[model samples]
Target chain A: MKLFSLEYGLFLLSVFYIFYLLPHRHQWKLLLAASLGFYMITVPLYVVVPFTICMVSYVAGLLIENTGRNEWKKAIFIMSLMVNIGILIFFKYVDFLTKSFFMALGALQSHFFQGSAFIAAPSPFNILVPLGISYITFQGIGYTIEIYRGNHRAEKNMGLFFTYLMFFPKIYSGPIERAHHFLPQLHERKTLDYELVSDGLKLIVWGLFKKLIIAERLSKVIDIVFQNPDHYAGIPLIFASVIFLVQLYADFSGYTDIAIGSANVLGFKLTANFNFPLIARSTTELWRRWHISLSTWFFEYVYNPIAIAKREWNQWAVIYASLVTFLILGLWHGASWKFVVFGLLQGVVLSAEFLTKKFRKIISSKLPEVVNNCIGVMFTVLFFSFSLLFFKAGNFSDAAMMARHYFIFTGDESRIYSLFQAFKLSGVLKLTFLAGLLLAVEYLDRNFDLKKVISRQAVVLRWLIYYMVIFAILTFGKFQQEQFIYFKF
Target chain B: MTDADVLKQVNEIFIDVLDNESIVLKRETVAKDVEEWDSLTHIQLIVTVEKHFKIKFTAAEILKFRDVGHFCDEIIRKLGAS
Candidate 1:
């Protein structure tokens, strides 16, 4: 079931009521059932596959934890990793592999592949994507790693462990909650607090506004321009590129808000997945702010390990580590070559920043603070937008054509204006207002909670602002249900 | 190799590596405390510490050190508990 749908809302309400009303000792069972119910609602048949895998992994983790022999522990850990990754690769990469293999055979002109005889043979089975498989797979892997590393004690209770992995609120797009933060909460007795509920509702409302009013609206234009880049070149493409930045932020951050807010209502605080990424003046700063959870996850688990593997390699090793991590990150998004290029572009930009640090320090000292800040922000936005072409394009050729048009600036400006007009000025104005609203809210909430700030205002002012926000969302919000952008990952 | 001496040396290295002259190190000081003490420059700190202390730390030990105090203690202990 969709997280924001009415049916899902009713399901959540029922789960919440029963969750608290159940005996404290039996709460884990309730959560486990709710999680199974949640997954079953989406993928009824394939639901058992992940559940069974998780159960086996849970048992294996307990075996590893209880085993006295170091060799036995290592064996168990490897087995767990192999199983998790095997499932992930089979589902995510089999098609890519099969396609590549046939293409290779075609290039070689293999006799077996003649007339599409062997190569075009249908697969024995159709692969069905389990809902939220990537998320739960990562969670399971992290749990096994933590157990192997002795960072966390394995949960003896199978129900609690299963519930921890399949928490419905975070099963799709996630903050990628770590064992340290999430597992402890599963064991705690949750007490309902009015403030928590109010804050959570506010967050959920804000998330809906971001998704419905801002992201979905912007997506309409972005999808249009990106789908037919040749038809709308230059300024139109540029505008769409900029809108993409907004769309990405709103879509992913909106999902995170819903996830965190839902969990918060149950007294489990999921990690904050974003900061004010748009305010970042540099690529590095942008990484720090955007997708904070995934970035930190990669840093801790992937980058740090590669970096520390060879101390003698020093700064070069660090740079290479960053590059490799980002490359892996890009691959993690999808098996597409476009994602590979996108990841490499980001890695190149970040690596350049590192390599030029000394030169920048010498030159930057002469520039005024305002000039530097402006230059930094411009460079960041321009580079970010350029890289996103890969993300937006249908293929490498499409991305190249868009890039060419972007730099040539040879498209008809009048045509761009007409195209904008075709979209309706009212839609454009609504989008602009939504963007402005997000910026204003982010500006105010840069340091502290905007809702809390509003709550503390004069009663009349507070009510006015609240009503205005609600009215704007209800009136201007895009009502078409669009899947979150990150759900594809 | 006293705690004070280690702190002083680490502080100087932090200032030099980060190019922030007014850096002050405390027990709880972390990489985030310095502007330029990013992942790249972090290796510079470790290398500099190794040279100064005449010791080496395993990757696992390095990863486990939470803050400057732990790092300093580990370095000191690695250098034959001087």
Candidate 2:
């Protein structure tokens, strides 16, 4: 059952009713069952792995907590970490490893056969990736680590831990809640509040509008340009790159909104994920604002540990740590060379910024503030767009071709006009309308909730705005259910 | 040194590392309290503290200090040992 679908809407309604109707003692069971039911709808058998892992970890945590010996507690925690990471590695990286191994063998064989006049082709492996595995595994690992650190107590109840791991709203894409934030909230009694319901519904509607009208429609043009980069050049590629930035923002933040909104309806608060990333004045600021949950995850778990471990090695170690963290982040997206390069480019750029911080400060002081801000935003956007070539292209060669075409501008203007002509007038209108809507909403809600503002406005004005938004979505929204962009990760 | 004196020195380190003139240190204040108290600046603070106080913290001890109060306590413990 999809989170946005009518069936799932009904399911959530029933679950919410049952949850609030039930006593505090039994409320958790309903949520656990509902979460499992939601997961079962998508991946029935694969659900067992995460469910079992959650149970085992829960037991292990309690055991560690009860143990008197520090050494035994440490051992138990290490075992839990190893098991969780072992499961994640096996399920996520098996196909990548297999293909890599075959490729390496083929390379050696080809070199040998060049002298012997023989040929052999390595067959690729087909792997069925489990749904929501990345999110659940990460949450599990974070929980284990938090317990180990004595930052949080381990949950003795297996069911509660399971619910924590497989919370339906955040299962697909996440705000990646930390244990300390989410667990206690789950244990608390929630009352049915009318304001919460209304606010949640409004946020969900806004998220749907973002996904359907803005992201999906823009994606059509982005896919067209990226699919055949050789056909178009210069301005068209630039337009595509700009559209991609919008699409990524809409898709990711939209999903996060829905996740947070749904959690709010249940009286659970997930972490805020996006923070006006496009408005960022620097690549460093962009990272700080963009996919904040994941960025912070890398910061706390990956970057800090590595950087701290090698602190005596000085600034070079800091730079190296940042690069390694970003590279791992890119690899986390997919098992592709393109993602690796894309990540490395971001690392290199950000590291350059860190190295030149003093020089940048001197230059900024010399220039006008407005001019400096413009240059900073331009540099970040251009760098981001250039790296996105690796994300959009199928392989390294395709990425190179797109980059070359983007810069060289060798293709004819007639070709660009032809490509533009291929898109429907309605698609163009929809894109323009959605872009305007997104920008207006983002501008208004730059610092606070736009919905709250609307709610407090004159009733007639608020109703008119609401109806117009709903009408636009119904009339112009792309209805095809494209999987959220981050689901693959 | 007195706790207040230690804190005054710590406050100077925070001001120097964070590049902020008006940094007010509190018992409950952690790294996230200041805008510029990020991981890189954090190491610089630690290094500066080590040089100023002639004390070193183990990784485990560093990780355990949740706030300024805990950090102060650790610093005091190190100085007392010396």
Computed on alpha carbons, the lDDT of every model, listed in order, comes to 0.80, 0.80
- Local lDDT at A19 for model 2: 82
In candidate 1 the C-alpha lDDT for residue A9 amounts to: 65
Task: Report the lDDT tens digits of candidate 2 across residue range A298-321.
Answer: 877888777777767667767888
Q: Model 2 Cα displacement at A100 (Å)?
A: 1.9
iRMS of candidate 2, Å:
1.9
Model 1 alpha-carbon drift over 4 Å, by segment:
A104-126, A413-429, A458-464
- Candidate 1 chain A: worst-modelled 10 consecutive residues by lDDT: A117-126
**Chain B TM per candidate, please?**
0.89, 0.94
Evaluate candidate 1 and give its CAPRI docking class based on DockQ.
medium
